[model samples]
Target: MKQQKGFTLIELAIVLAIIGIILGAILKGQELINNAKAKRLLNDVKGWATLEYTFYDRYGRFAGDGDGDGLIDAGAFATSQANFGANYIPPTSALLTPTTAYQNSDFDAPVATLEAAQLLPAAQNAPQRRTNVTNAFNGITYPASVYIDNVGTFNVIAVKNIPCFAAKVIDSNIDGSIGANVGYVREIDNTGALTGNNTWSCDANNNEQQLVSLVYFFDKRPN
Candidate 1:
């Protein structure tokens, strides 16, 4: 009998099966990688915030001068830039012009306009001053509900990649207040006003703030 020159049907089928299995495993691994990346980004953001808080507690101000000046500016919370390892930058577009007075409306207007612009950028290479998503990860999308609490005029927000699920400005002392779950918030003015205390809590478990204040990045696996 002549030697077989081609793979048998059974062999071919087996090979295909093996290939399918390998592909499936690779896809699964990719998903895990994505999830891990998202988690890392989130953790990094948390750490950065913690660092800022620690630094402020020690130095009475945030690190990294937002302005070009070298000296650390006092009470300049909004302007200072915080690096979270990943290259996620905020928007540069001006909102109602810069003013000396602290205005919550300033943050609100830009967030609306900036988010609109970001979700729908004018160009592919457009310069971004603020980003709710991480550029390091693929398929990372920031939902509309991502925002900072604005109670007591706490406009300075600290969040990462999150969906449009709103945010909560919870005061530890507050009792059954309806304002804690107002969806994506832009600022949390002051924790003292709502709870008769000065402790602000941003909980991600709430339906209103489902994805807000979370630095998550995800990648979709092939089906």
Candidate 2:
């Protein structure tokens, strides 16, 4: 009988183990990248909030709602009046609209006012300001805005990101779980109350989940 040249089972097991190790490393690397992106999103939200507060402190009024009119003052800025208004009230439901073909309207008047007052950089004017920033994890353009709520009691700045992406943001900033009082809220419609639904809320097991696209309002708004 010819001598068998087949390798022993030990060799095969070693190769399989090496492959598993490589796969695990790759998965962990991807998870770290995602977490970094989520943190950046949270930072962006905080930055905008800080800018709003700075504007308020300098001018004694919200950026867009100049003159304390509870509406975006067009004359205060160099943008169109239509692009600046109390359209993003109730922050939970306000959808960011495109001001032109290339840019989404993001606090056009308020940001512009900040620019005009020299509180914000002149380059940070509307039509070119940070309207929609890309989410590194999901490749989605999260639209941001600064506006006063309907009651005129709060100055709200918000970003609309998909539920999963938003969840990452909330988890990093607030509680790690998507439970009630998570410092963020989700709503089905622009006019409805933000309730924890199955789609956006984690199940009783506390697993991260997703729902329809939802807006994530920052808690640092000035009231």
Candidate 3:
């Protein structure tokens, strides 16, 4: 058999350099994507809060607070109306009172509630639990949600289903620091607790990659 000559140092170095460049580009691309997701998640929370507040500004009430209890709630506190009447008032619509029923047919009434009040254009009812923006990971599309939640002692509109990494970035960006239970933007575990409590999903663990919720206070803080 004829002996084969080994590759020159320059050729080997060129191959290694190309590999480094490809790896660097991939890492940079992933970082950029993560940043983009964080930004979109931030915008999602702000947009939902704005929509609810805009409804408040226009109708003096939240989109899903059928009882006008100053909260956007579901289940026992969710709107009980299959369809609102023409005379429905957003702020004080006693016609649609709260009742107990998990996953009521009208569970996703926030969007419809807004449309019924002429805030949003009347269209096909949105799928259950969809907010202003959706985040997709592992090929599963996650629609972030807005509802009444608390941070410490203050109630706020919580935006849910944000990736932990993205939530951290968002919290830092909003509050100028990262934290679990303090600041304008705070983290909430899947259990709806003010503190993450080192839960696998919102805190440290294998499930840390799981999604969590973030609450934006709109600068509403207790004195």
Candidate 4:
């Protein structure tokens, strides 16, 4: 009877090496994608701040902050997971004829105000931004709701539903600290309340859990 030969030792070693190289490439590609996502989150925060300031400069008041109280009086984001639903676009009329103010203001007013004035590009609309990021576990997209509350002692533009891992990357880049509970950038509960300056989980392994909404405080003009 002829003996059957399995994979030769050298052939097996070469195959294993090729497999390792392929896996390394895949992981590296994923890392780059994650890094790009983190950059987008950071840029969105900065760009939103710039928009608020630019609106303040042009109109002498912040958009969505109709009361001149220097806070974004978001009617939509009055509570957790409030209006500005996944597809909520402020009226086309509002978009086309936006004033520095609105009759019934909400998160919509800010984007509407800026859009009408041509300060914000059409791409900056809520629906567009809402799709930019997502809840990692369930794949739900979180809109970048412009609002202010007791996210801290000051006002903030609530960047919602950032998974813990990305949040850590962003917080570290902005605040120079690695935790989620303090700094101009804070990790807030889904209820949109600040529980005070303390640490929260930055578990490297919690990559897909939409752990918190990050509120970055801004110097909205004082009343």
Candidate 5:
């Protein structure tokens, strides 16, 4: 209180304005970061899809389905050793095989197979394979798996832990809306039903803003 030199009304206003600007800048920067992360995630998915096609084109079979039986060839089903590396073993069962036809779970065998075939980078083992793979933007781990739907279509499923993050990916790549016409479908959780969650819908009513756990199925044909 030696000077009691409180800022005048004008000074206070200026200070407040400066603070607002700084906050705005910080927020904008965060937004740009988020956008970049979303873009990277989308690119990774696309890259995987492309690799699936390339693998099929070169090997005449999908990556995880070594036998081309339209089922995930893993565990005892795997007949051939993964050629991507020396110690990598190909998945002998479907990593994307849902426990109850709806709930999704983490699988790394497909990734290992891809690595083994030189389609994806090789890892030391299954756990290492999974730990090494992560989303570039958010550092979120990706659960990569392959499976054949009942319709006989080969699918590569990539799991994202965050629903909103997945939404950003779908919006950036396919369509911004999480509703119909979107390239990817939304599911509540790995085990949850595949559809019927209106709240998570990116429809006009929902705005596709809500966040939940999501699994993305990238389908491809085994030619």
Candidate 6:
């Protein structure tokens, strides 16, 4: 009978080391992938923000009317183009002229008229409503005085405006501790997805929403 052959201890050790290296490489690759995904998501959010601003500029409000009305009518003032434009310009009669309130196709001209003003109060005073554009995600739910904190590692996620008497995010918190009320939650992936336990703070004193971090992924290496 032929003598049985077996791997020497050194050969076995080498094989185990190779396996460990392969596992490490795979983990590193996954980390890189996740990092890239996070960055992409961040970029996507920024792009969305741009679109939102543009929407307000072109149409006089945010993307959609929460009330599902054809026009950005009453109770839907936060995104009104007329209101935001009013806030942008100085008190010049041409810009501030009551007749200038209406520009977007969705709204009728001479929006300054009492009747027009009555149509969309929120849209008219959007600027005075809230400074930061409130995220009106279709199904995202959050508590009051919360906001998405984009600082430190992307470990913490999302934020919200403090619950206020009015339906606005800025006036939501009066104490200015809106930064401390940040919460952390897992990312949402499904329809009507909800993120819980996420940090809700101002972005590094920038007074802007970051929603992401710089070192997206750490210690990544080639597989």
Error of 3 at 95 (Å): 9.2
- All candidates' lDDT scores? 0.32, 0.44, 0.52, 0.57, 0.49, 0.30
The candidate with the higher lDDT, 1 or 4, is 4
Q: Give the alpha carbon lDDT tens digit for every residue of 118-216 in model 5.
A: 766556664455444556533333323433345443354443444365565654456446442234644434433344454355443554344444445
Preferred candidate (TM-score higher): 4 or 6 = 4
Residue pairs with clashing backbones, model 4: none
Residue 83 in model 1: shift from native, Å? 14
Off by over 4 Å in 5: 1-3, 73-106, 125-128, 137-154, 163-166, 180-183, 198-211, 220-223
> 53-139 in candidate 2: lDDT tens per residue?
675676565555534544334221122223443332222111112121112234445554555556545533323344333344332
TM-scores, all candidates, are 0.36, 0.57, 0.67, 0.73, 0.67, 0.36
Residue 89 in model 3: shift from native, Å? 17
Total backbone collisions for each predicted model: 30, 1, 0, 0, 10, 29
Candidate 3 on 1-223: residue-level lDDT in tens?
A: 9999999999999999999999999999988987887787666556656776787777665666665656554322122122222222232233234441213233345555655665555544332223222343321111123333452333355555657887777677777887766677766554445563322244556454577665666626432
Superior candidate under TM-score, 3 versus 6: 3
List runs of model 6 lying over 4 Å from the truth. 66-223
Off by over 4 Å in 1: 1-8, 62-135, 138-150, 155-223
From the highest lDDT down, the ranking of the candidates is: 4, 3, 5, 2, 1, 6
Cα-based lDDT at residue 130, candidate 4: 41
RMSD of each predicted structure: 14.1, 9.0, 6.9, 5.0, 7.9, 16.9
Better of 2 and 5 by TM-score: 5
lDDT of 6: 0.30
Model 1, span 39-114: residue lDDT tens: 5654543444454445345434333222312212222222212222123223334321223122321222223233
Minimum summed lDDT over a 10-residue window in model 6 is located at 214-223
Q: Candidate 1: lDDT of 140?
A: 26
* lDDT for 151 (candidate 4): 33
lDDT of 4 at 127: 52
